[model samples]
Target: MTFTSHARVDTDRPARYLKQLCSHFDRKANSTFDEEKGRTDFEFGVCEFLVEQGALVLDLTAGDLDQLDKLEFVVGDHLERFGKKDGLAVNWKRD
Candidate 1:
């Protein structure tokens, strides 16, 4: 099965949050940050902003599916819904 991920960009501190989230994927998510998009500042800013929002980075990857054997918590719920920008998205509903 092919896996697709939908994430919310912090636009302020992305790297830090990205790292925090990737930890679930073994503390080192397989994804790489692309600098060609001129997102160096935006990346870091988003990461920092996440800290303010009380959101923890999961850092999950497709491979983690095989090793951890843990499900139901890989991807986050707060992903923005595609095909309908109605401003109504499904958040994972933290307990």
Candidate 2:
């Protein structure tokens, strides 16, 4: 079975964060993104991003619970670092 998690990160600049994240991860993973949406394939799992008006939605999928948890932390931590000035937060719900 696959493990999954979702997070809606509130930020004033969703598009900017989305692009920033995709670009950063592209250096180490397979990432493709534009202004509205993006996807990244990491060694641990897959993360898909959607930029809304004032938030960035993240969907993460992995083969197991450990991978899912790792994916969530990695993505969320990077985003938090990137948006520290804006005080961004990523609260995830598992599925």
Candidate 3:
């Protein structure tokens, strides 16, 4: 009934990356980000992302298993772009 994913980024200043991501959705999606707390929360379709732990921890949830695939792709793509300079490796998987 529900699908969830988790990703931990091994990089310096992970919070900055998460903040960058949350900013991207500030205008379009219903979202909220707290850079100080290193947390970002966003709602996209049937999916939701909860990024915390200085951006090192990423939690994604969707209404259904199928929806999670697209959600994961979207999140991963954005993260890849943000971490491109540092070549940060983010390994996220269904959990």
C-alpha lDDT of candidate 3 relative to the true structure? 0.66
- TM match of model 1 to true structure: 0.28
All candidates in order of TM-score, best leading = 2, 3, 1
TM-score to native of every candidate shown: 0.28, 0.98, 0.77
In order of listing, the candidates' clash counts read: 13, 0, 0
> Model 2, which residues run further than 4 Å from truth?
none
Consecutive 10-residue window with the lowest summed lDDT within model 2: 4-13
Question: What's model 1's lDDT at 71?
Answer: 26
lDDT-wise, the better of 1 and 3 is 3
TM-score of 3: 0.77
Report, for every candidate in turn, its global Cα lDDT versus the true structure.
Answer: 0.29, 0.95, 0.66
Better of 1 and 2 by TM-score: 2
